[model samples]
Target: MMSCSNERQIITNAGFLAVVASQATAGFLSAIFSIIVLRKCGNLHVHQNCKILIVSMVMLYIVHSVSITILQTTQLIRYLTYYDPCVVGLSTVICFCLRLPASVCTTSFASLLFAIVFERATALWKRGKYDAYGPQLGYALVTISIIVSLASTFWAVQKVEFDQHSVYCSTATSQTADRVMLLCFLISGVNIITLVGIIALFIFNEFALSRREFDLQSSYQLRENAYVIRIMLPLSIFQAICYAIFSISSGLISLFRDKLSPVQHKTLYTTAY
Candidate 1:
């Protein structure tokens, strides 16, 4: 019969290998897509701000993918050498290190999407002026989001701990962590709201285009605008939904973590990270 320790070892190894394989494949594909988008859309003049925002978002995803890949690779290394799949460095340093990149990347990505929605709104309402300053506005929003995300994640990581003997790391149930989770929840909610707003705006634009009278040039421009919004809306909504669900689930799991069985807790923690 397999002892508990042996079972744990098997699980740890499987988890480590699974994370490594999945992260590597995802990172590779996302990197390729990022490169393609940057190359194809880099020089487009119209919707320049939107293009830049997309590239920035993709870059964040790439960074996140790389961070997770490095993390899992390290875990794989530890597993091969020490028969322990979890990282072996100082508890706080290694575990919280993962949180820093993951949180910053996720928060920044969501904020960028919000910025894109704002830009779209502005374009719809004030096409000429918004285009005049859209690129600058986009850049400013991205920069500010990066700064805030970094600060928040830095604060949040302080509450995370990695145990050498455990299969996964954990965030301490402290006031600080609670505050961080609240901030995350707020961001997720905002993302969802922004996505819905964007969808509404797109629908309004489509209705206006179909019903309102316009000259030839004006009609063409409105149609183009409507088409672009139609294409992007699905992708944006999908991202928002995914982010919202993940954030809500994580928050709930953390809140009720004490009630979870050991295996369930470990599974959730591993999957979350």
Candidate 2:
């Protein structure tokens, strides 16, 4: 017969193992999907510029997914060793490993989504002249995203702390950290709005294009652009929805900081995940 403490330890180990296994599975599936998209983009009969942007997005997604999985795996090891499970309470090295990449990945994803919106919008509005500047624009956006996301990462890592009784690491303990979380919520709101607006614009453009007549070559080009957008729109929408849920939850957590128990905070954070 197991003692009480032993039973509790068993439960904790099982929970941590479940989390680690799920994270690993998610990362594997995401990598597989990204690889397929990468290869398919190469073979796609789409504009070269669109292809470049799509492939780049896939690459970023892959990197983000893999980084998150690694972070989770690190947490799993920490639990196995009976170290602090909360990221905030961990040593600086573990803290950096867990938070920095996550911050950068989150911000970069939002930026890349906006960049895609720009590319698709330009293609729809400008029609034929898109290839002239699309790839250049995408590259510039990606570079800028990396820089901005790094800045956000720095801001988010400011005073992370861990509580043994708490559900996870707490970053909103200080006023500055609270402000940083608020900023994240604001950015998330922007992502949702921009994504929704992009979808609306795409629908309008497609309808307008359908009513117009063009030369066979121009029409073919338009169709190709539309095809690319159509294939990518669902992905954009899925990301936007996830972002919306995360952002709204973060905002609520930030707003009701004093009211939420650690378990509530953990639940919200998990939902965001």
Write model 2 residue lDDT over 4-122, tens digit each, in one string. Answer: 34323432555445755577678778878878877777688876656666676778778877776776666556556663333323454455555566667777777766776676666
Q: lDDT tens string, model 1, 1-273?
A: 224564355455565457555655676677677677667766654567767777788788778777766666665565556643233332555656664676688778777777777766766676534544546867877788788877776676555444433334334334345767776777778677877887787787787677766555455445556766765678777877776676677777787977975556545655654
RMSD (CA, Å), each prediction? 4.4, 5.2
lDDT of 1 at 8: 56
The TM-score, computed over Cα atoms with residue i paired to residue i, of candidate 2 is: 0.76
After TM-score superposition, the amount by which residue 225's alpha carbon in candidate 1 deviates from its true location, in angstroms, is: 3.2
Number of the top-ranking candidate, with TM-score as the measure: 1
- Listed per model in order, the count of residue pairs whose N, CA or C atoms clash below 3 Å is 0, 1
